[model samples]
Target: MKQQTKHSDARRPLMAADQSGQGARQDEDASKRSWGSEQLAAFEDRLRHLRLTPSQQSLASVVLDNPQQVAMSTIHALAGELGVNESTISRFTAALDLSGYAELRSVCRALANRYSGMLWRFMRADHGAEADSESGANRSQGDGKDLAGKNGTSGQRERRDILAAQDSSSIAASFARIDGVLWDEVVTRLGHAEHIAVIGLRQSQAVAAMFAYLLGLVRSQVSELSAGGARYLDALRDLGPHDCLFAIATQPCSKDTVNVAQWAKSHGVPVIALTDEVLGPLAELADQVLIAGTESDSVLSSMTAPVSMVQALANDVAAVDAAGTRAHLERQEALLKSFGAYADKDL
Candidate 1:
């Protein structure tokens, strides 16, 4: 019975669109205009069909309540408040076929400012028509329970239809930026830094550690800030003027991460932030803000773009010191072999 219910729920979006031509047309127009209404509707539909993870559902509710105010800039803070990672916010944006949270915010703001009058009237008329149609359908059904069931089904269908209308190209384009000049810039920065300090909290902390490890292979003076309440403050105390802070922060922002960036800036340390949007607080504090794509199909945040950025930086740094790095590796390999660290199985 549960399986049957789930199947029925999945089909509800299509059924609702079939029943409401105007609603379908409105969604289509919103997609064409790159207005966020279509994306918002699709997310709501997916929630109804697949049942969002609790965190996703919470994020969805927040977006719905403040459609105009919510932006990619706020993703990290929102996620933190919900006890989820910044990546989750990226995934949510990706699911909507938005390049990332920044694009999503631009669309929402554009739609709100450009079409507010028209949208208000359209929404009022649509709601009135829907209410009338629902009333008539209920009257025709006669049985109250049957009417209730039909209304529930209709609501479910509306949500699915919206999800089906999202654009794939938008999502692909958002991710494509990672392979371009932005990544090159990140690589150049890492290659030049005298000392690198990687700072991130929660999910971003893992990415920070990866950057530190990769930098250590070539430059030696690389350190990763520990997770919150894990000796990060003590580690950061050693940061100085010739150092660079490579920060990874995403929406639903972290206070500690922002503070670290600010501190680095005040201490005459350069800050490079890998982030989702330019409007985020961390971006304002950063010497360089590398915008990484965060669109994903699941509730989890998308790390592919940021990871690619880090790998590109690693490669570039290695390239810049190729001869020296190779010589160092050879010496280390020889020492390890002499110590039997690379001994064969027969030995």
Candidate 2:
């Protein structure tokens, strides 16, 4: 007869097995760190127990959001938009353990390329199905009046019609959702803000400028931070508790724009972000997030949705401040009339 082993003794082998499994996991993790040496080093050196200093994090998120087009020119513009000094931008880079803005950009570009390829593949797959269906329909239509021909033709036509209707309905539904998500929030937030600071970079700067101009008509203290050079930072420094920032960032985001948002948040300022998707880091920092749809026929970002949202917000703000806005508008109209800025047709 063999001696009986205690339950605890029997469990010893199982416990040892578990420990071995944990050891393997640790080894695998070590291997991964070794494989991604630069990334791991950067992460450990810069991001370990990393604090974003608010402004720096905001700016970095913006740049990370729009990986494809981030550049020094964009960064400089973003710094102006956020009302932060250029040194803040450099600090943001160092915080990421990047050599500077350029290296950060190179990393973003690589990421962008990877995403672009994936997007193209998805697009191709979508179109491929449509092509196959269309070809099948044509073949059915080409056949004469045999039983198969009649049945196939009718079936194909009905299917095609159904698909067309489905496409139309899908597009309409998407647009409606976009309108609700983006424009409605913008209007609501603008109404709540005592003062609005508009921030945008690169192509979005125009949008920011336009929003500020229109908000001025409502007698709102609307500042366009995009054009003030270092003065932008001075202006931001002066904002009181009642002020809110409306940051416009699309994919890919400008690093400067993100930094500014971080800065504003750290200072206890509220931010309303208009961007492409909720996944963007800027959206994470925003008190209110507005996601605008970017799917369009063009390769460039579709600004139409965001522009419409801004316009709607401006209109709502004006309506809310009706009396003051009307007076301000009248003054502006009088000035324009005196300058003969209207069309000659009116004259």
Candidate 3:
């Protein structure tokens, strides 16, 4: 919410990694946005809404898909890679209404940062005062509401509403990409696999653990890679053609997940990737790719949509082999009840 540093006033058409200067850093933060909007939307959403010429479309594809690479590349390198003149690349930025290629690089760098687990995890918000002032101004325009009169509860409720709306939107957009047939296939493979190994490291591990637990309830031989006492590779010792490896990764995809997934693929293990981008490293290694939107308003991207999708997948897996799943559930319930795991079994 800090005031966007004014680098250029004129904007037109289409637009490199200069990571050194303080001015460059400020521009990067301010320029973090989809071409069509003031703030960033999901990359896919932005692509879908934009009206791009064939040449521009091709260029945008390269830029958007490889933000990390582009963030580090100079305009000359990018233009050469795409068989376009450097001037043409600058024109492409103009088409997107950017001031120039420099602003474009800033945008891509900011975007790439969100996908970086390290950067996203550690970056702190430094715009609290600016953000509140803007919010109050917007409210004034909407209903002439005085900020001083608004209670703390109103602010809290507004924040909650924003979070809920973002989550709901994210879920809807992600689910739209996967069709019924694909989902059915996912359920069948997971349900009938001889073994299931789910691997997620870092923050992604939280979702992976929950997914593994849900899968365990519906079937046997469901093991979580890297979640328990055993190291992930050690757990993979017995994994092979008969088993499946489900790996969850996000932007600036984790190398560990990608490497493990690659190993699984080489050993004939089917890899299902739950990731934000189809072209992401983990998705490249996956035999089955499940795309999920992870865009968020804050430094941390939301996992709510991906977590919801996995939950639904678990439910479908449970229903795939109804009789077998029911028997498993009954046995598990009896075992837990026998151990008095429930405080009130009847309830």
- Sorting all predicted structures by lDDT, with the top scorer first, yields 3, 2, 1
Model 3: lDDT of residue 23: 45
Question: Candidate 3: misplaced stretches above 4 Å?
Answer: 1-125, 128-152, 227-230, 345-347
Give the better candidate number (1 or 3) by TM-score.
3
Put down candidate 3 lDDT per residue, 113-166, tens digits, no spaces.
654554532332233233234322121111222222223887767645665777
What is the TM-score of each predicted model, taking all chains together? 0.51, 0.52, 0.64
Q: How many residue pairs clash (N, CA or C atoms closer than 3 angstroms) in each of the candidate models, in the order given?
A: 14, 14, 9
Higher-scoring candidate on TM-score, 2 or 3: 3
Q: lDDT for each of the candidates?
A: 0.58, 0.58, 0.68
TM-score of 3: 0.64
- lDDT for 328 in candidate 3 is 97
Residue 305 lDDT, candidate 1, scale 0-100: 67
Model 1: residues with Cα > 4 Å off, grouped in runs? 1-185, 228-230, 331-347
Best TM-score among the predictions, by candidate number:
3
Candidate 2 per-residue C-alpha lDDT over 1-347 given as tens digits, one digit per residue, 9 for 90 to 100: 11111122331211111245764453344333321446634542343235666576446434433343343234555566557887897787776656555555555544454455336334433443343233221111112111122137776675445444444543443345554444555565676677888899876788888888888877657887874568778778976567889898876676778888899999998788877644466876787776554533222444666777677678888887678778989999999999988889845
